[model samples]
Target: MERETLHRYRDIIPDFDAFLQAIRSERITAVRWNPHKVSRARLIEELEECFECVEEVKWYEHAFRLGYEEKPGKTLHHILGHYYIQEESAMVAALVLNPRKHAVVLDMCAAPGGKTTQLSALMENTGTIIANDKAIPRLKSLVANVSRLACLNVSITWNDATKIQAKECFDYVLVDAPCTAEGNLQERITLMPRRMRESLSRLQRNLLAKACELVKPKGIVVYCTCTFAPEENERVVSSILERYNVKLEPLKLKVPHAKGIESFGREQYGCEMRKTARIYPHHLNSGGAYIAKLKKRG
Candidate 1:
């Protein structure tokens, strides 16, 4: 945990050990992302310095390059498909989901195509990816992004994840299920609806069940969320473990210049928690997020 974050949370949990212990217990609390240095200009500056993907200038400007010279977000994302403008936290889910190049995968709630597109990149444009979303309009966006990225292996579906029950159809499944957006309150302030708190848990339960059903036996199923609620995070995960024949896969998340997030969920929640990773804002210089890797057991 970051010092600032610990300071903000010291009243509730005294030290890093205590904070983690609490998380292991599944006591609902807010997590802080570190460095907190996600300015639009900073992201652009970093992207520009990297020469590997020069074609991404258009994506840089359109998707999220807030520091465009003029007319930011006009048609640049469409023109180049240089990269997908996605939430920094959201990317963690895909990386941790750890798709192999030849693995058949399913992204249950792929829309605006962030994770779907990233999977394409991870697979180096190989294998089959079935990206499904509930909204027809969003599916179109996913299609456009996939097409623009020149990924021929991806297929888009506009249907609720709950209804799709292809048994053992994929080597892996990513359920970046929708949540209350509590972890994003600091960034996406548009989460102004209070009524959603009551309904979000139920929705998550529905999504988790469906995701577990679609995953193949002995395959990996990753459950991720951008919220900090236990009902949505640890509780949903535990419920799945209890209700289904699945086990948690602890993720030692790795990225360039990225530190690993610790698992406090094991002891705190009265369940096997190490199989999943929980990230908070104070853990690193990014947004608050909770990620758990669950694999179907024999």
Candidate 2:
């Protein structure tokens, strides 16, 4: 991306060289969308998944324009489910959530069922996961995804992740709250960084409260976002601390290589920030992400 774009956020310190390398490594062609699939509904859905609706569509077409390259989904990774075509770094939330067998987990905002399915895998398919999203249309996709994943421990529910009942019941809740997604700017620059500040802050608190509210006494809540802005990530964690006695959970990331892990804080949420981890595109071959593990102190 652009330096001006990277300078605004604390997490991003992009290396254009590496960026180029990543692009070169990508299996998907950088083409625009296929003309045949350009309906309003399809466009909107892909936009949500890709975030960079216009450019991504263009890139899809651009890729197609180059030639009839094989789609990534049709590859072995999709069959193995080793890697998923998720909302970019959205997978981080599930990794951060880390559900255990016999636990009751709820993925608030679980439509498209990415995190929910992951949680099922994490729990060894022994725990229960209530996957909830408000949109009926999106719910169908969620159901389809969970079914495709063969997730036996999941139950599909149609409810707004924020306003639903079921307080203090879940052993763990992954509130990967909706935000303006500044980290997503590499693709969605049309949505500016400054404009995302307010939305990020607001959703942070709402997500924290909702997640904290549902966590069983002494249960853990992992809050995450794709955006790197501290106002959203840490401030949201801080807000949760102000309202409840919560402690940050340390993230043990052994797979992907990370850098400058110490650069972020320990107590931004009113306690030491030792138990949290944040990853940027610069840190590893991953999209930008902020992850914090919060335990309800009760």
Per-model TM against the reference: 0.70, 0.70
TM-score of candidate 1 to 2 decimals: 0.70
In candidate 2, how many Å is residue 120 off? 1.0
Model 2, range 51-71, lDDT digits (tens) per residue? 322233231221211122345
Q: How accurate locally is residue 216 in candidate 2, as Cα lDDT from 0 to 100? A: 91
Off by over 4 Å in 2: 1-4, 10-70, 75-83, 86-89, 187-196, 255-271
- Model 2, residue 242: distance off in Å is 1.5
Q: Which ten residues in a row have the lowest lDDT in candidate 2?
A: 59-68
How many collisions per candidate? 18, 19
lDDT of every model, 2 decimals: 0.62, 0.61
Q: TM-score of predicted model 2?
A: 0.70
